[model samples]
Target: MGTPEVSRSPTKSPLTVSTSLTETVDGFHEFKIRSYSLTKGLGVGKFVASETFNVGDYTWAIYFYPDGKSPEDNSSYVSLFIALASEGADVRALFELTLVDQSGNGKHKVHSHFGRALESGPYTLKYRGSMW
Candidate 1:
């Protein structure tokens, strides 16, 4: 036997393709909250929510759940998220969160959308109540 016969599915349709674009900003909002540890006493259930801030053209707030966001975690880990606090839907943007080290080492850890290539434009908020 030299070569094997290849079978193809004729019923399979061509895949549809979609693409999106994200706008980049020259500067960041740089909202810093000091004494973050003090907020831990607030306890779960919206432990601490940042004041409404604007990023791009939409308003947003940072929510920190020191005791985990869902009940499944049982407060083992801290959960941080960004919430859309403005009107409109399908809003898209890039974001980054940084946790500063109190040691003054200047080696803060950062997580951001720019770490990976965006295949679907900016992050879509979907609705006014979306979170990321």
Candidate 2:
């Protein structure tokens, strides 16, 4: 009778990562464009920023691109963006950008990351990290 030899390989257990998220509506800011006409003529890719506001201990601003960011579009549409305007690292939050109707009909256009299911998660913004 003969005995068989077996070999063993060195291996480590798989590492697991866990993250818990606490969601809160930390802050809100309302911006108004008094004269929308004067905002034009800034040329493509240029933007006017709203006064800095605070949200979650971070400064924020709304950027209005009157002529849109795309030069080829030729002002076909206006672009608006929310930006993290202060010093921070990997700051995360949910946001809602809304265009309120002043006509008093109560209809509004809104782009939001609230009261809905997110495929990934909330957004993260670093210091001055924005397309605008």
Candidate 3:
């Protein structure tokens, strides 16, 4: 294989002490949906909204669909998304979603947007962005 090439960009140089910002979250909220299985009957591309919960200064909800969110998937996979309920633009945040296993074991499926190289730092949500 040929040697890999690395690109040096202006905006994305490297993280340094002076250009870093730290945020500490005291705690988090766990909103469990008991009847998650019942959503399977929902039509394709359909989703059910969870009760609104407060986190930090904004209200948020979890949108879950037993079928896939897009038509191309043909309902093979479940689609999940977090949406902003409150206002204010350019919201920067970190989030993690886990699917717990029911086999009486500790293993669980995890998906997250954190721990990745954020070119301009954490993602900036547009004013009331949907399907985040």
Candidate 4:
């Protein structure tokens, strides 16, 4: 008689995603938009300041939406509030609003700042937004 074969189960590993900045609008000054894995440090934590700008002119706004359907679908959205940095070395925290779906396959919008500054140098800013 033949011996019975043994069975084994496959192991699972952690998921790591790589995100990039899709767009940066250069209006009054320069604003940058960046995306990264929520598990990674890029999504949250202290923001390393780069340059200083006129506080009066330092105003920013962001708009976000899910990938599929519109408001009728009861998707998710986010809004960001930005301000000028008091110092070049100032560090800030970027907020990440959670969307209904864990997957970021939905469409989102970010309207604020400009691409000029982002294009000029390497810097990070504070971001505050929401999702539903």
Compare the candidates by lDDT and give the number of the best one. Answer: 2
TM-score of model 4 (CA atoms): 0.21
- Model 4 / residue 56 / CA error / Å: 4.8
> What's the lDDT for residue 13 in model 4?
92
Compute each candidate's TM-score over C-alphas: 0.66, 0.68, 0.68, 0.21
- Which residue pairs of candidate 3 clash? none
lDDT of 1 by residue, 20-127 (tens): 985665435555667877766455555577788776677888877877778786767677777888886567676777767777889887767536455545688878
Model 4, residue pairs in steric clash: 25-114, 25-115, 26-114, 26-115, 30-114, 31-114, 63-109, 66-107, 67-106, 67-107
Give candidate 4's error at residue 63 in angstroms.
16
List the candidates ranked by TM-score, beginning with the highest: 2, 3, 1, 4
lDDT of 2: 0.75
Estimate, for each residue in 1-132, the C-alpha lDDT of model 3 and write its tens digit: 999999967787587665667664533556565677787768778987778887777777888777888888688888777777778745676677666765559887766752454343555566674555
Q: What ranges in model 2 sit over 4 Å off?
A: 1-25, 103-107, 113-119
Q: Considering TM-score, which of the candidate structures 3 and 4 is the better prediction for this target?
A: 3
Tens-place lDDT digits, model 4, residues 1-132: 899998979978989999897443334433333442332232222232223434333433323222222444332322333443333333232323222332556754433232233234533553322111
TM-score for candidate 2: 0.68
Clashing pairs in 1: none
Stretches of model 3 off by over 4 angstroms after superposition? 1-27, 114-121
